[model samples]
Target: MSPLLTVEELLALRSSGSPRLLDVRWKLGGPPGPDEFRAGHIPGAVYVDLDAQLASPGSSEAGRHPLPTAAAFQQSARSWGLNSSDTVVVYDDNGLLAAARLWWLLRWAGFDGEVRLLDGGLQAWKEAGQPLATGDEPAPAEGDVTLGEGKLPTVEVDEVPEFVENGGLLLDARPAGRFSGEVASIDPRPGHIPGAVSAPATGNLGDNGRFAAPDVLRRKFGDLGVSDDRAVGVYCGSGVTAAHDLLALAVAGFDADRVPLYPGSYSQWASRPDTPVATGPTEPPLIDAAEARRRVAEGAVLLDTRSPGGREKTGPIEGAIIVDRDNLDAEFDFGSAERHAEVASLQTPIVVICGSVNGSGPVAQNLIGRGFVNVAHVEGGAPAWHELDR
Candidate 1:
């Protein structure tokens, strides 16, 4: 059976009153999910607090949102009026990013009955012209559902290296910016696990905000090298959004038992100084200014990644090709019609430089992520280059 249910299917199921609805409306930094649930939520749906009920107290060792203990989760499930044989549907406003957590948690806890995500989530319900309830629903009767543990596979922090070493695909389900180390708000560091692929959970959804058809998702994962022959694992900022990828993999025809979650994810990984973290698409080699100059002299493309004004202040290198630091993806889109001719080929020997090593390192890595092979960055960018001349 599918892991997702359409709004129409949910509505029909409601008539039977056998499926329990869970509204897991949450945002990273929120105005509070309960507040939103109080404003309006699906009729007969109970609000599930992602932080309070779904997770245990977190620390640097665990993630920002570690999984709740099975006993604790059972208590929470009982409070939600979950019966032993009840079908469950979970939804949230932001494309199942939050809701999939509940769906995954239930399955992981060995839920014998079916558990599914409401495709497109609350937005789809509203779009279908469904009526919503305001304020709060009455407290539900305590349920007698018995929960178990280890129904789903998981990867411990120590196992990550071996998993990747054994050719298992570890997918980082965070946004591309976070995966690239361009923007990191919560984690101890930016970037991703050394060998993890940047498979943002958002990509599972189409323009309509619903998950793409199974065949489409299959093609997407196939392109990412997700074959039946290899094991696949997923992780996110904490572990919540990672489930979104797990669900997508299931929908894409991958065996649910084969895909595992790295519950500690980036938050825990980054916290450990001993573990290696990769920034950008690849951690490009850093070349000295003299080496950069020599490479440039040997017909290598010198990609000056600085703002127009920053370049003006530094005095541009004679042969450097200026690229806007903020728009590297667009500037280096080799497949696009407007692709930069100098670095169009994946084999192009490109040397990147910015104001300093801090600036140029990520740019070189970004380029590598964009499929460039022979790429490096100036160790200290313009300042180091100027020192070479002096």
Candidate 2:
């Protein structure tokens, strides 16, 4: 069990030059750069932009935040002085939300050294009356960390069904409301992966924007059915916020398998008709017999769009695979898989849906723009699950 360093321990490390700090700050739907860090930051800390470091620079094929090539990401990390010997503390002013982006990056880059988050980030550190620095920062002394090769073990939209059937854990880090599909917010899809555990990123922080104690986090995660050692997979709207939960799980001192962050997540899953989804806030929608039959016969897949709790009661149509809307078109088979450069002679058929009739419609619109043909949707979603009967 790795123990979360106390504030005092961190203070000593900073004073003793044990850790190198990296401040990661980002705004939703903004261009990629480090304007925030240029204004002011922790002394000696470099900046890691969420968009640049975490996301790949493409939209058509790779989903947003497609895991960067390990070598390139490693070069970025090394340029910032993130090494195996020095403790790397990443922080952001917006609570743990943004700093978590870098914390997860360290793990992905295979820096198995002292990696921790500055509790409350810049705000809490300032509120606690810690020191501050400003102006263009300098890079680290040496740079040499190999970015290992191999798939980071990400499960596909179709794999969640078996994980749930086998009783593995699926965690969602979106806010509770969006998790319930009550508010879709940014993504076109309305719900979550069926049978996913809804543990909002907010739950891991106190009002101060800092992380809770290790014991508190341990108990909280334990209550949510996450064991110290489990095959845990996590996701957010588009693979962003979920990193916060992964960091907190790391902080809780739980021995666990290498957790995979689902990159496309809700945004990609919601877009395609072939992907299955669910709705509402009760049933744990999953790939059971009923959903499979509906999908096979109806030509639609189960789309789990509600929060995990909602899907608990509804379950999912059998063979109904999960898909999110944001990054789906990039990953979908939009007839482009075939070598037909003749500009899609016949229309590719699809059904747009979220957790309801309202959910899957707009997704259909995005698909239409992307050259999809015959786009339709599942009727009534979760609210009218019975509509599938007839």
Q: Each prediction's Cα lDDT score?
A: 0.85, 0.63
lDDT of 1 by residue, 338-375 (tens): 55787645545688999988888888777656555457
lDDT of 2 at 212: 67
Clashing pairs in 1: none
Candidate 1 matches the true fold with a TM-score of 0.75
- State residue 207's C-alpha deviation in candidate 1, in Å: 1.0
Best by TM-score: 1
lDDT score of model 2?
Answer: 0.63
What CA RMSD would candidate 2 show?
Answer: 15.3
Candidate 2 has what TM-score? 0.66
